[model samples]
Target: MTDAAPAIAAAGLRKSFGALEATRAVSLAVPPGGRHAIIGPNGAGKTTLFNLLSGALRPDQGQVLLGGVDVTREGPDGRARRGLARSFQRNSLFAEMTVAAALMTASAIADGGSAVFWRRFDRDAARAEAAAAIAARVGLADRLEELSGNLAYGAQRQLEIGLALATRPAVLLLDEPTAGMSPEETRAMQDLLAGLPRAITILVIEHDMDVVFDLAERVTVLDYGAVLLEGTPAEIRSSDLVRRRYLGERTQ
Candidate 1:
């Protein structure tokens, strides 16, 4: 991404499922190298917006631009190939796959080298080395042999982030990485996220106000499927509407 261009730009985004309008003409920008947080209550269309941005779901009307390309119509895989990646609120991993195995498989898929996983990975040592490196980076080296389902829930979540990182994406969309985590686990996740290189942009949908304020350089508050406000952490803290609808009239 260039210094002057936005990493992600959404314009007039709208989505409807049956009778409910999930997103209503919402728009926002995640600046280059920015850690931007999206916060809203339940049913505020937080996940739906992520789906639109990540190409998991198409917007009924609008445009999603990544870097400079208009990618509203791109499917998930196409967007991924164009340097977009995301993790969901639920840990999306092969529950039966070992950490090392899962990372190898992910690296193979994301690298776009081959579909013959067993022949390509088992014969090549570089794939194993790369997968191990990614596993260690996410603090899962110790659990390399553990089945994904057998690991703790927080560990599973960490693995999901690791999988997204394996894609070498320019923008990483995190859909509540800290959701359902214990306080200690959440802090660990926050540290891992903060320690990431500044070259990568992270746009996160987070409900934990503490995490948002601690990690996000900019904050976007969504209420009732629209951008209620957008500002720095301090500005968000002082906003009257944010206080009433999301911040509970007191700083979190």
Candidate 2:
């Protein structure tokens, strides 16, 4: 990809289930190393758009470009291998596995070591070190031996993000990273995300205005399956149209 190309871009994406169009001509471009956010109400096609971008679902009509390469037909794994990773809104983890084990598994899988099932993960020095680094990066180093299912809700969220980071993605799609977090947890998550390396572009779908406003360099407001506004946080916050159509006075 050239320097001018966006890390993630969607063009004229459209998806429908029978008569209900989930996404309507939605298009966006996230610059390399940029932090962007997508926000809308419950049925505003936010997650649907993520699905299309992340290769969870194919768009009926559109193109998805990853690092300037057309990947509309790529599957999730293919896209992931091509430097795109995602964390779901809900935790996706091995509940019974220790945090260290789960991160090791993620790293091993990313390294195409899935067939080495007979060997203990801790025996692989490379993978172990990688896993430990990821754990520290996500602030879970203290809980390495703890079961993933037993982690506090926020820590589980952190582990989920760690799983995504194991792949060393160029673009990370975070779907409500702060969901279900207490105020303290939310603040911690915000700090963790803000500290991520600027080389990794981030696209977040969030309902929490505080997180969105604080972390996003630019905001895309989706409403009725289309972009209603795309601007800096200050501009979005001040847009009378966005306030009337979505943000409302409460978000202001």
Candidate 3:
């Protein structure tokens, strides 16, 4: 493994909603191109930690680092500009827009261009090409002309990832990408994520234990708003602490 600085790092992060302490001194470090999964019980502050990392919510204390540079103060847009992108728990799509149009719009925005209309593409061949490439990468090339809302639920999720990929992000944060998916859809999503190049560092929050174990090279378990354990899947599965706290399994 290379010794490059961590692609994403959280140092002593904390967040509170007045009476509720959502995150308590949580910290993480994900190496470049690493596939890391965060698994936690409900109310364990997974979402809160995600928000702080994405700049959606500022930490009440501590710092966020991107490629070893402090970015705790940067907003979401700023982070995006510096190669960070995220997909939410719910699909975020331009419902009325065609897949091609939506992808083009996202690509244009990433490049600091006016994404007013796809019809006005004569002068934006680069944007169009980038969008097409992203479509192929996300398995949406065949659905380019289809309305985003009209695509199958799984396809819609694929498009959601495509939108994020359009930004050409170096680091991707996926929040429950398969939350509402069927077993088949979940498998497809897993395959899609597995096929992603190592050029992108991935961090995911997922409820599906199978998905977490399948995709993650390293796993972090959270309980009561703090890290309970971190290790390879085998280590975590064998840990009585993780089994009791997060997996809810009876352990000897």
**Top candidate when judged by lDDT against the true structure:** 2
Model 3 has an lDDT value of 0.86
Per-prediction TM-score: 0.91, 0.94, 0.93
In model 1, the worst 10-residue window by lDDT is 87-96
After superposition on all C-alphas, the RMSD of every candidate to the true structure, in Å, is: 2.4, 2.0, 2.4
**What are the lDDT scores of the predictions, listed in order?**
0.83, 0.88, 0.86
TM-score, predicted candidate 3 vs. hidden true structure: 0.93
lDDT of predicted model 2: 0.88
**Per-residue C-alpha lDDT of model 3 across residues 41-118, encoded as one tens digit per residue:** 778989889999999999999999999999999999999899999972223446777888888877777878765654
Supply every candidate's count of residue pairs whose N, Cα or C atoms clash at under 3 angstroms.
0, 0, 0
Report the C-alpha displacement of residue 223, candidate 1, in angstroms. Answer: 0.6
Overall local distance difference test of candidate 1: 0.83
Off by over 4 Å in 3: 88-93, 249-252
Model 2, residue pairs in steric clash: none
